[model samples]
Target: MSPPRVETVLIVDDSLVQRLHMVGLLRQCGIHGILEAVDGNQALELLSALDTLPHLIVVDLEMPGMDGVEFILQMMKRNVMAPLVISSNRDLSLICSVENMAQALEIPILAAWKKPLTKQHLAEILHHSPDRPPPSHSTPETHKEASSTGAHELALAISRHQLLPYYQPQIDLKSGTITGVEVLARWPHAEKGFIPPDHFIPLAEKHRLIHDLTLEIAGQAFAQAAHWRRSGVHLTVAVNLSPRLLDLPDFVSEIDALLQQYQLPAEQVIWEVTESSLAADLGIALANLARLRLKGFGLSIDDYGTGFSSMQQLSRIPFTELKIDRSFVHRAHQREHLRVILQSALDMAHKMSLVTVAEGIETLEDWKLLREFGCNLAQGYFIAKPMPGETFTGWVKTQNTRRHGRRGS
Candidate 1:
């Protein structure tokens, strides 16, 4: 088979030797059009002068001036969407931090590899498809999608009950059984197909529609769970809780009433919230969370490591689960730095007697690695993307068949 076809790449490093080495590897990978820059400033200048963005960018974290982190921030500001690879000999921790920073800025980072770039690493990064959708060029459709979404439009959608709930299955890593699912809110726009939550969620919050949206999503999830219980599935259902809803005077009571209305058990539902969410109205949110927990509902500290005071939150709240963010979990098998962080997180959760879940298990290697590390549950694109509530029963059957076949083999 032929090597993957990458037409152009830009190599950013202060070291002349490193740039030359990268160019050699690009040629080896059948990538001929190579652009080199001595530092981040030079790279920006090159980018400004070019008519098109390169297919990939490989940069060193440590540079003489305008380092990789600043370069990425600048790239975000300039709306450069090229895929990124961090090639740094610096400490893996620093490289990992930079990778996280870039991801937070919405830059598509492919991988972070230790310095002294190797042909194999370059091949892996270049040939591997990123988990995220590739950045779109300025096509008319892309431009149309990028156009501003009005908060009023979202408020109208909520009022019309147009928002839908999609379920992402979570698996028991060791047993290969379907533990439950995380419910995600999806908008089925008449004209736009399915508008991503990232597009409308902020609008919901900004327009004071988050409370209604959350309730709509939770009601659907609860009713579905009750339906499944009657059908003998007995799977736990989880819903993302907006921080804005926690401060409501009736938040806990309203949620409990919904559970009773659907006839779903509190223990069978999980409320997933970020650590930062609890900070919005600390006293009220904590009281509400405590009340929910006392009533036997599961509480998860979602995206465990990304928040400002994760440890503090974990210690203070009566959380039942800890979800390691995708950034640390997805590439843990390949990046030692990430593995270190993942291991620590797993260990910490175990010591706290909280069930540990690793999200974003995309590759088989990472899945196997997390299972070996004894993660209680797993979820991501590897198992399945979020699907409609009505189709989850069939998905469970397919998963059972695959599990049985593996056992037989």
Candidate 2:
């Protein structure tokens, strides 16, 4: 009744410590018949020697010879079809197409682990594997709802222009005045009401639709930001960039054209790079980020502290903002050690001249704690949930009017 488990994992890495630690953890997590390879060559030989195939492979990005990426390429040459979870210090597998980069090499990346691994990171990798699927319904509407929140129903929503930017205001600690808004995409299905990004983003990625979705979201966000700039608000609006678009040869040029088309100043539109997405190809990713920065776009490191984006990478990656990942912020108030961690992160970001933003704030205590740490910008449900551009504009106007009346009275 153990669900007829059919999972065998091969872990390849050069570090003896990593190998032992990972193997022990996999055993703790219910992994079966684990195999070890120190480098790509050994891993290749192991597969060649075996008649039965490994159900899964976990690889470190770095090894003495024929690194993890090279191993994946070779696996493609042999047409190995298995689920893979890459463990690496470099974080490159998450952003780059590990499965698609090598011709005809297909591996399902359950997840990528950033180095000096945490139990949480390991759990996440196991949970995200292709072997596991989050609970779902069997209805077609659910699938359609997930696909685009009725955005896919072009006939109904295309004319309606249903795609909208929902802004979550980020506050400045010194003054409670809203310093900026992080633009998040929202799709309202006629039947479903509000469909979350998690529901559809994976589908979009699977269908290679995120590239276009990113552009559409940017266009909408830029227009709203431009409107605010015109009204003397001059607030920075950050939009998440889809990883698929990052590698596109013309990503930089495309963004430039969109900025011009919307008449949005590049400085006002902050481009968010998620940690997992950029870990895959630092060179290519950083190169594109540099191009964006040179063109006047503000670069922000999204989900900071969630991956292996070292301080060195931040200093060299041309980022203008460091968003403390919610994991650290959520526990900062309850735990003393966590407070030190959060404070250190804040201190480090400020030292680097990167504006620090706290994400996933849920409680007033958490918000106050972040503010106490000299963390300036923040976003979370405690502040305001993401809503349409119109809703955000109205919220801003109302806040300003209330302040004006309070002062006059």
Candidate of highest lDDT: 1
TM-score leader: 1
For candidate 1, lDDT tens digit of each residue in 1-409?
3756567788999998888889898888888889989899999999888777787889888898898888988888878788989989888778888887887787888888888879987876866745443453323356465246677888888878788889999999888899899999999888878787887888788878899899988998898889999988899898888899888879999999999999888999999988799767789989999999998899999998887899889888999999999988887887787788899999999998999888888878889999988899999988999999878789888878988999899
TM for candidate 2 is: 0.62
Model 2 lDDT per residue over 222-242, tens place: 888888888888899898987
Model 2 clash tally, residue pairs:
5
Model 2: worst 10 consecutive residues (lDDT sum): 133-142
The regions of model 1 sitting more than 4 angstroms off are 2-5, 14-17, 27-30, 62-70, 127-147, 334-340
In candidate 1, what residue range of length 10 has the lowest lDDT sum?
131-140
- Give the C-alpha lDDT of model 1: 0.86
